[model samples]
Target: MSQLQDNFGRRFHYLRMSVTDVCNFKCSYCLPDGYHPTGKQHFLSLSEIENLVSAFSQVGTQKIRITGGEPTLRKDFTDIVRIVSDNPSIHTVATTTNGYRLAQHAKEWFDAGLRRINVSVDSLDPKMFYQITGENKFDEVMRGIDAALTAGFERVKVNAVLLKGMNDKDLPRFLNWIKNTPIDLRFIELMETGLGRDYFQAHHLAGADIKAQLQSQGWSLDIADIDDGPAQNFSHPDYRGRIGLIMPYAKNFCATCNRLRVSAKGKLHLCLFTESGLELRDLLQHPDQQAELIERLHAQLAQKKETHYLHQGITGVTQHLASIGG
Candidate 1:
């Protein structure tokens, strides 16, 4: 009875829990300029987050990922991973970070039974780095990536957001970097989020053009199947690891999307693109209403949009990417 299967006949198994709306780095594509952080009232306590994740586990939720403004900014990050890891039905507990804090937090989270780590690093150029993230700490991110490697995160994946005129020219370089190093690389097409499209309007490089660029570079990569999550993975012919691509405009995967996002404020979002969400903060107040909350959640889940509408993140909601839980 807990199974809320989607239109694709796939059970929505993965829960992307956004721990906090506080991110250290404000990337141009993600948050843009003048983006203010969220207040404390919007955040869910460690206990509340763990309790909800635990309930989802009872209903056959096996995968949970912690995201945030930057998940590492949360003090209880490691505990969140630990709590989810201990759940019997939860097969994987992962987090996607900006990697700035990974240098210190990597081993701790890894020891807490975290299964995977995804780092968002769009470009390799340091000067371009400043223009993109408004932060001169690109070196810190690289160091963090190395730390994750040293911490036993054998397959740390790098998420690169591709823009038509901006970093799209570096597709060859990204592939070469993967071929040379042990790190995993994935290309993400830029979404016209309310904040992103408003400030940044560079042409969005299509997926086919991206594919052609890599193929023309003579890179032989194979596709990897890691659920219907954003990235469509591709591996080099003789490489040790693979590369991934998550296309929004060219190839939207909303059809097979089994993702559910929980905002930092305790709102359970059934679809990333849709503004509709079920509030869990009120439900948490009356613990007796837990079953009612679950039923409401299931109803919302079934109505998960086939995919996100492309006018971008114009929900009139002020929640930034940090609060959106990525």
Candidate 2:
């Protein structure tokens, strides 16, 4: 089979598969109102996911990043990880979580074949973390990170959304933490989603400022791998850990697009900010649908725009980051 290449000649090999849309944290930029179920909740079954992943793997997908509103909320989360990691075509299996369950399940998840982990730790200060996430589990989350490292994950990553007034001054603390922690810390620019437009207006910070500061302080840019996400990685010999910046608003940001998203409900989203997703549940019913599924995926790649309209304040149908596991 040919690679999953788009008209622009960008070959996609990374898949961000969402297993559930239910998140526990109430982050201001995402689900500040918390998660509320709409209609009868029907997520894809394990069999359906296996079939979907198998189809993606057949079409040159090598890195599978299991995502979610909170993927660990599902009882079968480890099984989901094992299924994808067990695929011979898959080279890496990763997941981004809130780290609420990491202290308890990190070892098992690693044993289930998960190799890389990204934990969402927006702030280092306990009070500030609570203010942003509406959860007072800062200390617990820190413990979870230690647990992840102990569970045999080589280098764990922590993601923080750059909020203007909230946790903005915590950067020094983060730097101090990573000085000897060997963690890969990333700061993501605040994005304007349909649900968080007002919040974004109040707290959107450009990641470039942080990037510039890092450069001035002796950090050097590192070349990205084909399967890596949008982060521009940086490193310094003095520091044990590395820093990454994800500036979606930067010019030609989508020029390096190499990943695709699949919602938990079995919809293939060519881009995170696309207005509509192609319904794929109909084609995920059986193993025989693999060929048709791959064909459908290729067909949708043509519809992917050259870039997202986020610069123009357009957020498409994404109400919040959690809706599609952003």
lDDT of 2 by residue, 247-291 (tens): 999998999999999998989888888666889999999999899
Q: Candidate 1, overall lDDT? A: 0.72
- TM-score to native of every candidate shown: 0.89, 0.99
TM-score of 2: 0.99
Runs of candidate 1 exceeding 4 Å displacement: 38-40, 198-200, 216-228, 285-290, 311-320
> What local distance difference test score does each model get?
0.72, 0.91
- The C-alpha stretches of model 2 lying farther than 4 A from their native spots are none
* CA shift of 299, model 2, Å: 1.0
User: Total clashes, candidate 1?
Assistant: 4
Best by lDDT: 2
Best-matching candidate per TM-score: 2
RMSD of each: 2.7, 0.8
lDDT of 1 by residue, 231-293 (tens): 666656656557777776544566666668888888887766567467887776555666876
* Superposition-based RMSD of candidate 2 using all C-alpha atoms, in angstroms: 0.8
